[model samples]
Target: MCLGDISARSQDQMILNLQGCDIPIHESQDFKDFSEIGTGGYASVYTAHWKITKTKLAIKQFFESSTKEIKEIIINEIHLMEIMRKKVIFHPNIIKFYGITKLKDEINYAMILEYADGGTLGKYLRDNAESFKWENQLKFANDIASAILWLHDNDIIHRDLHPNNILIHQHSIKLADFGCNASSIQLEILKGTREMPVSATNRIFVNLYKECWEHEPEERPDIDQVILRLNSIPKSHFDSKENEESEIIDELDLSDCDVQLYY
Candidate 1:
């Protein structure tokens, strides 16, 4: 077969795979007022107003001059988003993927996503460091865990999970930036060994964190189990703990942990 034939077959297979997925193909001209918001290693995101719906949306456009390897990564992420959409139509804590649009005079495609009004979690936390309370911290942790559970339930692993990747929509968390990474290493747990301040409820949380950081991947608790553990920590526990003098938050300080990331 000629190269043209192979390319045609590959396109056919992609269409077949996308059949019944119900994801829309949007036209680049349908959006206007594009303003760049964020940029990553592979793609740059823009805020655009959709002409059809008259709604503001985020347009994540992959770099146009990307190599074949980078293009493949972009395509893989599209497929991953499609798969997650197929499994769950809407997830409260996860970012919503609307459709795709090809930029004018460009071969690469851009993804239409819901706009997060409050920006990234990292920036939000930094801005509100002074007034951030225990209750707000609890809610953020729960929201993140809930989003991770949804991903795992749909057989998708969010390999790039961090505060900057997590966005704030209104006052809630929206998990984003799903990337490709399969290898894993153990993260050090700083519950028992560290001399950080801890309450009864916090001790339970620390134990759960330790379980999640188990050296053996199989021994680690899944996201679902992690959620259950979080829920099990009674509100009363936090109330009692907060009633006392507030030294610091109960979360494990990553700076104290010896976590080494490769690539």
Candidate 2:
């Protein structure tokens, strides 16, 4: 089947599962002070404070009385998050999934997730395009590649691998939004924004991007091969010094530095 058809099938299955399943929904009283931070076609994300844990979190709230397509998408996303949680494969480059919540009177469902202070990589690059260093860009690419490799290793394909789905947290890349089952080749070309300067990006990244968006799915390298290629790139100054204990300590101390990139 074509990518669009595959996605349609998946959505149909998800809708059926959602309608038939009796999934328990937790009370939304645990979260407070929800402030809208971001939004997508399916849901709106809010930064909320978890009353129980006293920690900040991102709550993705699905629209009330949404259409079947949007409901299917939300259910699929919840299903994917449940899988990740059950597997216990908590890779650093992947966003941390918490749990789901549903208010008693509201028709909308909410998903609790790790709050990414740095926001999406696409926004970060747009805001800091002029001053963002090449080395950091490479690091972000490596981190994203590693995350993708982990997902593939676990038999999950990130069919929607775009900059908006890639988040920045603690100055590191964390891949997000893996609910859709569309072909990667079909969606690869739609990964970045139009304003992004493709020519200005590192040559290695440019080549990798081209390879990823190839028309033939079989011709594209698997995630492991992609990781190998990213690893082969020359180490940055910080990476080179990581071998020294003192330098490692310094790096740990500087972990909170504001240089953040995504995707």
Candidate 3:
């Protein structure tokens, strides 16, 4: 079947259960309060507190007025998350998925997720430019590579793997904002503006970066190979005094890199 035919079939199979059985509809009282944290083309993210459990959570809300096409895309995204939740199991580098909620007579539907207190990796890199040493960059890159390897082993392609979609929590990296089908190489190109730290110019790091951005998808190294290469790099390279004091490039322009969720 053509790609369009496959997509059409997938959308046709998506059925939303309004009865709070599979995915519950949480009442407003369940959450103490919600504050907007971020916004994408199809949904808005809010940080909410669970009244009884006293747990902090991230909720992505999708409006009801969205077109059928957009709703299908959202459903596909949710389906992909569910697949990962069941198949890949849990990994430290993968974002945790809670559940979905839809209120009665409300146009808003929400998907509850784990809240990363430290925010996106892109933001962390920018804010800590002075302190983002080579050692830390290597750690973050390894975390991301491990997560991608897990996803690929489960037969799922992230399709969107940029710094902005990589969240930081407790100084660790977690991959997020994926599901739609796209070119992996193209996604890397989209991340060019984020650029590697000056310290990453080491021969080993340079080779891995080039392999990741290879134009031919098949020519690109698998996440496992990428991880192996990253692990092979000498720790001393990152420990050099020059790398420690290297100035960070503060020219990241994210305006053009605003990737829409489920696009």
Please list the C-alpha lDDT of all candidates, in the order they appear: 0.66, 0.64, 0.68
lDDT of 1 at 187: 37
lDDT of 2 by residue, 33-82 (tens): 88887555556777889788789988777666456666666666767766
Show the lowest summed lDDT stretch of 10 residues, model 3. 1-10
When sorted by lDDT, best at the front, the candidate numbers are 3, 1, 2
Which candidate comes out best when scored by lDDT? 3
The 10-residue segment with the lowest total lDDT in model 2: 1-10
Candidate 2 lDDT (Cα, whole model)? Answer: 0.64
Please estimate how well model 3 matches the true structure, expressed as its whole-model Cα lDDT: 0.68
Candidate 1 vs candidate 3: the lDDT winner is: 3
lDDT by residue for model 1 (144-260), tens: 999887777777888877666778898999987665642233232223242343544356767887677665679989887888888887766555444332334324243412221
Count of backbone collisions in candidate 3: 0
Which candidate should be chosen as best, given TM-score against the real structure?
A: 3
lDDT tens digits by residue: candidate 3, 1-263: 01121233343232364543344346766886788877776678888898889899888887655556666667766766766665545888888777667544555467778888888876776668677777888898899888888888888777766666788889999887764643345556565533443443556777777777666689888777888888988887776454344443354444434543311
The TM-score of predicted model 1 comes to: 0.75
Q: How accurate is candidate 1 locally (lDDT)?
A: 0.66
Q: Tell me each candidate's TM-score.
A: 0.75, 0.73, 0.79
Candidate 3 stretches with Cα past 4 Å from truth are 1-15, 18-25, 103-105, 181-200, 241-246, 251-263
In candidate 2, how many Å is residue 77 off?
A: 0.9
Cα distance off (Å), candidate 1, residue 188: 9.9
